[model samples]
Target: MAPCPGRVGPGGAELLPGTALAILAGALLLAWPAFLNGYPLVFIDTVSYLAQTIVPEMPWDKAPAYGPFLHAFHWRMTLWGSLAAQVALLSWMLWLTQRGARGGVTPAAHLLLCAAMVALTSLPWFAATLMPDVLSGVAALAVFLLGCARPRLSRIEAVAVLLVGVFAVAAHLSHLIIAAAVVALVVVLERRVGSALRAAAAPALAILVLLGANLAGHGRAVLSPNGAIFLLARLQADGPAAATLRERCPDAGWYLCAFADRLPMDSDEFLWDPASPVSRDADGHPRFMGSVALVPEAQAIIAATLADRPFAVLRAMAGNALAQLALPQVGDTLPDTHLALSARRMVRDGFPPRELAAFDAGLQMRGLLPEVAAPFLRPHLPVLIAAVPLALLGLARGGREQRALVLAALVAIGANAAATGALSKPHHRYEARIIWLLPLAAMLALAPRRGRDPGLA
Candidate 1:
């Protein structure tokens, strides 16, 4: 084969100059967490994922891909292997995406841009963290590869892109829907601007994998418990769903009626709190409320509320959409609960005791850190909000293929925003997963100087 066919030129087996250095630079930048903390950083969800990896059963809501990957990495006694693997895969996929973009970029430029990402954006945070958020952004690049770079791809490159996209979808339930939504948008753009089914082949196969994985892991063929309950929880937090609950509870015989008065104003708090009606049982045990018995009631409330007050639902969605558009603050790192729970899980699962000791030792070194990026990234949400549309406009100024790429990114962001922002609730981490793409798109647009004219490029 042509030495690493994924990076090979048509002329010979030799890879692009500095390609290895660029990937190494990207990987080191992404693995900064491990370098500093002696382990990968984690979110609260990370504990559940770790537990899922060691435990026999799949989590009710979590997708199965990352959990198993973590299990495989745990054999080495620390999370460094998992973090390193994540950074390497991310670096490789990013290199492929940039290579396939318009004029392509020098490997030096790629390394410099990767450094910029580490410094200027939350790229390193998600990348180094033990969560699936980083993959969501990578999936966007895969979408572009499949949609705009198909003709340029060698067979190995095509397979790599398809696998990346599929794995991205398998990482999270919302990710699968978001990827599907982007693919749908690509299909529409192709119909309007002229592409081909070849562009969608990867995404189509990804959807099949998504369904199959869900079936295998959760014993269900659904994309994800239907998302109707979460949507209902969101509406409840926004006021109208609670109003509906109060009106229809006694006669309708729904469970949430009892606690409608005590529901939290925050969508995430309400949905995730142990005492919330969605997950709590009368006997005080945690219950999986996504069962068939609860779906119809949640669906009924959603249907009635929308039918009675359509404008209210739209207004709520808009508010959350705006919130999700803003970039997450840098201070939004893992909570103490995440560390404690993760450590507990490690001990319970008989993980290497020495690794846990090292982890604890690393914790003592925490102190008042220099405040450079956090101060600026917090209040500069407006800049981040403006960047996405500007990136799309910049892409439009390029050739036809770039315009299609722009559409694909827009749809991906829009669908993700709707799903995580409105349907669930606006959280920084939700949007952070995809917001890195705006800067990436801008970079790609500027890198192609020698390509066709702005109109034809």
Candidate 2:
């Protein structure tokens, strides 16, 4: 049968010519923050990621994937290109997901959602910033939709979602965990959607990016060469490792024995401070954080800590994860005008002079971005809080598609908290990065089915 006029046909297979325009408009809407900043918003780590293009090795804490992605999209010119691409990808995912949830919609409706998201959620902030955090949510949604709602999506949309998920997994290790959780939840809750089991392959294969990067950088095929060091830092921050360190000091002859008295240091300080026991040498110089010798010892210490204080480990993990869930407020994303001399030098030497000038002149760099963004934070929290009941209502509708999306959002958000807060440290940006999906899920569940299109909600 011929499709009815104005209604999307066959799982949104047709991308009308105007759809591209709508997507671009949506992209620009979400990217308005970057435009206002006169440059992409810079996290303190932006410099580190950008430097990967010119630097010899990946930073211990960052994956090599996002840097290359940024470098390729930016074409070695300005960071704006990378921001544009991130915005475009986010726009496309939101559009397609909205279509699947609604069964179909006019381009105007999708754009309205984009505008609302920009006005009301932290989505725009993450989308506008030069960070892999944006892609974590993208990958979570992709996995669930492709796994549980593939029947509701066109072939083109399926391929695109898979590609997006691949990029996401390649870009960050935490995304790999998020994807795993989404697939696990979908497969468990909706086994009829058997593809959810198969969807795990994308993230499974994406691990090669880390393996390759590790191989090239340290001649190792490990997924994370410094993962143990990170785990140790988290354990120390959470209190378990301190006990182990105290018990095993001097007798163990570990490098960290010298700092046994300072067992429970903050995770960020343990990892980044030049004078930190984790990062310092006997002479007080900063050591390469990914030092090969540290990994095995860190692993040993973490294992001993877990053995000595299993309950403490569990308590810390739960506490940190719960703490992370409550910390979705947006901050620390503004450009740091107070970058260290080394980082400043890295920024200057990393980009062309023109790009450097634009970076320095951004509203964020000038410290004005926060004041402009402050008002939005007020509205953002309420919107997210409202999304809780809205998402529950969405589940009540019992449409597999909407239900899968809601479940994916919860799992992704929870998994992200565990990965970042339990294994690392709780931070606002971690949850803020992916919370936009709650509203998107609610919108989909409430969308009324029309014409021959299946009823969505």
Candidate 3:
């Protein structure tokens, strides 16, 4: 790998003066909540991760990375420390992506880009949050940058970026799928792509981390017991699961037969509604929601659905992908009852009372909003939806290395959309999480280059 222009020291060590400043600036900007509320901002999922951390258990719905990361720093300052780390990691990732492209950027340009992202995108909101949602975006960028420019990266940069990317995937099950999709896309395009192995590295590590974590935490190696139910939820939303339930009732011996007509259209409602059949057994304990039975039932129903109406299933998946790309909303940021309970549990368990109290007070304060932000930022929903194809087209005009950079971003976006839509229902967050890659790519495309590196190109 070729070193960044003017960055390699006598021993081939790359200097990161600008990246350090960017990291500092990003930490300050993203940690605004800690200044406001004496702690970092947290979401419903944040509590869940914290709770799992305290229990040292693998949760059915979430991956184990964020919880452990949070736990590692919780005793020091809880929210702020973890959030500070998140900001630092995110800053480095942005810097690596930029540096990986066209050699490297100046400290001022790196800081400016970080500022632009905070001011022009929803990055700060995500970076400040306790959820793993933001990491999904960071992982996408890392996968693209690493995949397209691995040969140009220093050993230290390569390892750091790989760890960050893998951590992102390990933080969320959905993100694992997203990472896998990006890797697969890179592999398919490897002839034109630079390094599919670089892209695949994070996802591969994520799987290993998941298995290792589950084994250490739960005395098992399985990923998530709840996957099947999420699939069943998506199927229920599309009608086939319910149809199969009705057809297979009585003789099929599944308990879902009795309430097949009452199934909800929305995935959340079906999966979490108190009255929904999936939420409980006859004894009122959680049954199909996260039970082992869900796997077989969901698999059976999906297989039957595809066998019966393959075209319909495909059409629904396509629609789901399109719907997932719609405009993101402020309401998407709101916490729910379940998440609130999780937060309270975390507070009751180990989070400092003072910090929790400050967090409650901070919720009353209007935190930083992007100076020039809107309901939906520039390029809009439709444009973002088409960003991949457009990016690929634009990349065609560039040299091979530049094209590889852009193509990785484009492929990551497409892969995220497809995986999210097919494996799970299309939610705005699914697309919004990775959508920033479009604008990020645009910025990189327009940034002043130091002339392409010979090795990568």
* Candidate order by decreasing TM-score: 2, 3, 1
Q: Show where candidate 2 strays beyond 4 Å.
A: 1-14, 282-293, 335-347, 450-457
Residue-wise C-alpha lDDT for candidate 3, range 1-457, written one tens digit per residue: 3322423322233454544665688667655534544446566666668777576555667788888787776663556777778888887777667766656655676678777665556566677777888887877777766666665566677777888888898888877766776677566655443477778889888889988877776577877644777877887788777777777776777767666777636887877677567667656776643445566676676677678777767877787877765634333553333534666567656766776666555542233232213443453454455555656665755434455567666666676776677668776666666667676676676565664332221
Q: What is the lDDT of residue 314 in candidate 3?
A: 80
Q: Model 1 Cα displacement at 118 (Å)?
A: 1.4
Worst 10-residue lDDT window, candidate 3: 364-373
lDDT of 2 by residue, 1-457 (tens): 1111223225436556677788899999999988888888777777667778867456776777888888888866777888889899889888767655555556788798999999988999999988898898888878876776565666666777877788798788888899898888867865653475547756876787678888997678988877888888899988889888898888999988988887698988987677888667766877764345588999999989988999999999999999999988777676465554433565587768987788778788777888887887788888988989989988898465667677788888999999888998888888898878787787777677433222222
Tens digit of lDDT per residue, candidate 1, span 331-414? 555444545655446534656777666666553223222142245354335546665666767776765455555666667777
Best by lDDT: 2
Question: How do all models score by TM-score?
Answer: 0.84, 0.92, 0.85
Q: Report RMSD for candidate 3.
A: 4.3
- Candidate 3 has an lDDT of 0.66
Point out the higher-scoring one by lDDT: 1 or 3.
1
